[model samples]
Target: MPSLEVIDEHIVLDILSSTVRLVGSLLPNNIEVVLHDLRNPECSVVEISSPSITGRKKGDSVISGARRDPAFANLMEFSSEPITYVLNYETQDNAGNPLRSSSAIYRNAQGMPFAALCINADYQQIDKAIALIQQLTASELNPTFKKEQQVIISEPTPDNIDALLQEIIDIAMEQNPGSNRPAIKKANLVAVQRMQERGIFIIKGGVEKAAKALGVSRYTVYNYLDELKAQNEGE
Candidate 1:
């Protein structure tokens, strides 16, 4: 079976290639996708190139050679959301001379992102043409609007667990915060009730371990067991 990374890379490459071809046909320059794994210590997964961007080939890890580029580093760090930016004035061209460019980042569903799309617009000619058109019209020309880049950080929390037994206690306490009652007692009661329903307390070492895991005292666990026994006897 092919690795998940390989499959994901192929899918992303195909999508990026189709987009590049579709958009490049309408525009003068080409677009490209550069993939890097942010979760796995900056491993290059794939690279889809355009005719305009020289030297970069598919499957060639660009970072291995050009690790010093801040744009690439920033793309890796800020891959959680789409970010658009204009290259700094001092940024160099393929010929090592200064050139202007734009770039964007895209993230995946798991909040792990590693793709960037960059385009080098022909600004000199476009600016000149726009200026000429401005002379013909009496209306004032408005400056081009650039979108601001936003960074979203997602931290892993305990609530991310699927079968979070402690979540019920947390929610119950939240729903009744000012009751002046002990939250630990409420949690203990809830845990005991659940254990009775599930018959998990019958298993050896389960009750003690569960109590320790849930940050409750052993005495509380024994008390819950006793209450459960009393309730069963009454029933």
Candidate 2:
């Protein structure tokens, strides 16, 4: 029968130390790594990197950590397991902020586990980012939902010159074409001045149409327009 390969004591510790350095270099600043000496439970934290993250320094007891750490607790009962690792395990700090962590136990040549390596990664920032994304995508408060939109469409500008000119002539005639020629001539001059302001005289055929509407020659419309311009310039 062939003898089985066994891990040496010095080799195991050296391998673990190198692993600690490699993982420590690769992980971000928010992550922490702690090496526990199970043989010294009362002071199990033999080494720690990023002490600011876990709030622990070297020589801190593993017994205290296992007592409070949900992910790292129960280490004493895991002596027989060749290798154990947990993922996405919930861990909370002193202020109750959450973390994601993984831990493992490695045994020596004697088939007795003597050490533990744990990694605690703070995921509070990630959780905050996820919450913001949720707010952007699945939010319930919508300004467009409860408020009403009102549109006040105004009346159009630029009336049709011919149609408006006819209407104005009709209105002036109906306003009592009273007894004398002076009164009738006054009415006609007033009507022509109003049409010029209404932009009618500036259009093609407007002077001819106004002459016919007043039963006068186009020259008379021109005279009325000149008089209105002189009055405006004097003002």
The true-versus-predicted C-alpha distance at residue 187 of model 2, in Å, is 99
The RMSD (Cα, Å) of candidate 2 is 39.7
Q: How many backbone clashes does candidate 1 have?
A: 0
Overall lDDT per candidate, in order of appearance: 0.47, 0.63
lDDT of 1: 0.47
Candidate 2: residue 202 Cα off by (Å):
99
**lDDT digits (tens) for residues 15-98 of candidate 1:** 875776677666654233334333332233344444343344444333222212455435544333444343632233334333
Error of 1 at 60 (Å): 2.5
Give candidates' CA RMSD values in order: 19.8, 39.7
lDDT of 2 by residue, 55-103 (tens): 6666765532311354454443434456656665777553445666778
Clashing pairs in 2: none
